[model samples]
Target: MTKLETAFAPVAPAVDLDAYFARIGYDGPREPTLAVLRAIHQKHPDAIPFENIDVLLGRPISLDPAAIDAKLIGAGRGGYCYEQNGLLKRVLAALGFQVEGRMARVLWMAPAGAPPRPRSHMVLAVRVPGDDAAWLADVGFGGCVLTAPLALFSDDVQATPNGDFRILPIDELGGERQVQADLSGRWSPTYQVASGAWADVDYEQANFYTYAHPSSHFTFSLTAGRTTPTARYALKNNRLTHRDATGALVDQRDLSAAELEAVLRDVIGLPVEPDWRPLLEKIVAWGSAA
Candidate 1:
């Protein structure tokens, strides 16, 4: 093992190669190279969706590596940032890539001039082999996730299967940056990232606030996203929104409980247990009441 591996050997979850490869439908190279990084970035999100099912079900979302593997990789369940990014970290590390833990403030949904949002969102800073600069990679953003890795440098438009993406420098002096998605000639800010070496406790605290806080939207509503080469789709509460390859919002509609179940099972390819459907009924009823 390398020095980095020796240091992380204890904390990193042992990845089940068979299971993870199957989950992402990727059977290609796992070298610590840019090509592998981009391929994994594209395929991983296409397979494991960005979802908050546990939070919506009023259950505590576990950030423990083993628990994440059991729920996401083993059982094929999806998760929010803390869980989803956590899994990606392990997989990349197990594949021999140097992955750093970082946190970002979610500014996309924030109101202008509002107090700065917490650095709650987690991201991976990767050191791909044969590359001079590190790369920013994430698979946990439920609304707009990058289907390709972006260079850490700023302002250049990066291409992804989902859309044209970029991370523009917001405060060059302060090293603050924002990720943007190009949608029909409009650049939509996804989130702002600041410089910080995020620690494990930071992620735990963020997960607590996002998953357990009564005021958090994840606690009361559902948010799920899936990406494909042809389209990207999101489920927010009862609303299902679809965007085509060009980043044009193609479809938006409310889903009935039965329809929601079908989307979960078919569109997202989640194996929704029979009993889970009843809980979904409650969720739909609760949404209507809300």
Candidate 2:
């Protein structure tokens, strides 16, 4: 099968279910229904952090399932969007969620007057059993990702444990929906998404550009993210930010080497790979990241 056809092609739920469930510390039902979806969604970010350490180090990321599993699940490391969502796609399909791989154009960090960012982001269009409406589930986006799947409605307010998220229809192109996020109360253009049945090759190309190109922020900055029931925590470079229930900044500070290391290990649950220990120190060390 071509990569596009295999991107999220539902064949059989034969993925290692027991291992995935164990990884997420989820003891919930796996009945291929929306309830299971919600249970899995809520537990994922709590267990797996969103990070891009390998990319920043110029390690060639392979989208191969085995590589993703080994790095993220086996190595106790975290990954950025593609790795996170790619792993989720397999797990959701293995559970019979009828999920498809999708792409989005990011605008969250676009420079003013700069063209819309590339369709570098990955999203999932899921068909929940017994529901007429499809839902958008993304466990990848770092800054303000969906902690729970949102019903794919343009104006409906969806509540998540971390914050309120609502999608607004911006423009439609060739039957695809253009949506933006209403994070807290601010409006920011998100990405234009489609059923996006292209190829794993397409995703790999985008992932390559982000990590290989100098202009891409992921190539240079250090970032990590995790969401809890009460708040969201994000660490970019050496600056750490914590937002409360209302998406208000509860804490923001430049973390010292000790402090940043603690947050990465304890809060984000990512252990330093022995080879990257020195790099990690220099990246988060006082005054060096600046």
Candidate 3:
């Protein structure tokens, strides 16, 4: 087997369930019910955060369960989608929930008339024991992240802790769906999710591109986001922004080098490495020019 395949080999939950629960500060029911999923969906991002620091640091993103557990759970660091959702997949599976991986073409900030982007974003389709219908769960969408799973079979608007969301079918057969969120009275297309089976190799390939491709935004930018019950915090380069639960901007500011480090460590709750000082300086300088 290839390295990626081996790293992703199916095994009993490699992540310690207790460690994961503690990492997210979740003490709710362990059952694979919608309530438990919702509780975790909200708590995961709030505690673990979403970040691309490893990509910016030129580190290969690993899908090995041990590595994910060590970095995100044990080491007090955050990661982008693959790590975030991949870990969630294992945890949910360990909890006896049926989980499937899915990919999406991100349209969150795509300019008008831009060519269709690749399917680079990762999400989950989950099935509870008693429910026949599936739900969409994703905790790695950065600033506008979802705090609850959206029903896969419904086109109706679903309410989450972050904001209201709707899953719109793109075709008559429902082979594809568009994920939209209500943003300040406007329903914006966040991404188009494809109804297809996804494998570990697919995630590894997409992760490789995200961390290594020059065109990938994760490789060039510094981004960290955390969603709390009251507000959502986003840090891009050196700009720190806060938006209330209603998607209204609360405040935004450019940070200096010291302030940038402080925000990453304190506000975002990332273990900002001392070795990242130089890179943090560059981020601050770029933010000033932008």
Candidate 4:
């Protein structure tokens, strides 16, 4: 069997491949390069949802391909990096693309001189045929996600409905990279990929830190979001912010604890059990206080 087939063969045992593809809106001939990407973008919104439901419930996040597939594709749930991007990497590889799992440190730019703090984030780099630079594909980030693959050297601004994005080299930090959108000129720091080759195990270890660390934002927030052509629906803490097509913040409403739980189940389409209602209430309470 080919490397690609072998990597994903085990995934099928745990997940129905056809059902998984249908869940993500993937329906086309298997073309590793661009077809899979377009399928994901068409079906799944750019803003996937980085949530801490499992963390709050004391369930350890699994980095295994089958486990991720079970949570996302099988159970009809959304997840953070380890679950979202990790599964995307497997799917890409199974479609014959050269995929690498990478870790990124988040650096959020602030107004008036606030410093950037590093947080753990996960993404993937894929080497497509006839392409010199690896394309960054991520379906896990809460707000900003690439709708299409980006060339490594090009600084040309790629426009998404949400914002304009570009990646440029950072010389000051010893070759660190920065990706920025029109929303902020201050570039958000993603991962610094090592020149040497990385094994899947390397990403597995990094995934552990991201999900298990107390400092990770995924540990703190039950954030979920979805992006449409004209607007964005984001559930951050107890407040939901809707940004319009013109990049204006259109609406921001704070929800009560009970209302927040209802929104999660009714609006966002996440299935919450009776036992989980209290946890959702706790998250809403924390969000209100924050």
TM-score of each: 0.91, 0.88, 0.94, 0.83
Which 10-residue span in candidate 2 carries the lowest summed lDDT?
8-17
Query: Over the stretch 51-136, how does candidate 4's per-residue lDDT look in tens digits?
Result: 66887677888877777777787777778766777777767776767777666656543444655554356677788767567776
Best candidate per TM-score, number? Answer: 3
Candidate 2 regions off by >4 Å?
Answer: 1-14, 130-132, 176-184, 285-290
Q: Please, what are the lDDT tens digits per residue for candidate 1 over residues 1-290?
A: 99989987656668787798898899998788888989999898889998887776667998888898899888988988888888888888888888888888886666778987667789888886555687899998986888888887757898888889888888878888888888799888888877766765668777899988887778878888898888888887767899997788899987888999999888877888787776688767766776
What would the TM-score be for candidate 4 when compared with the true structure? 0.83
What TM-score does prediction 1 earn? 0.91
Per-residue lDDT over 57-89 for candidate 2, one digit per residue giving the tens place of the 0 to 100 score: 779878888888888788877787788888888
Who is ahead in lDDT, 1 or 2? 1
Task: Report lDDT (Cα) of residue 250, candidate 2.
Answer: 88
Sort by lDDT, top down from the best = 3, 1, 2, 4
Q: For each candidate in the order shown, give its overall lDDT on alpha carbons.
A: 0.83, 0.77, 0.91, 0.66
Winner of 1 and 4 under TM-score: 1
Every candidate's CA RMSD: 2.6, 3.5, 3.8, 4.1
Error of 1 at 166 (Å): 1.4
Which residue pairs in candidate 1 collide?
none
> Candidate 2's C-alpha lDDT?
0.77
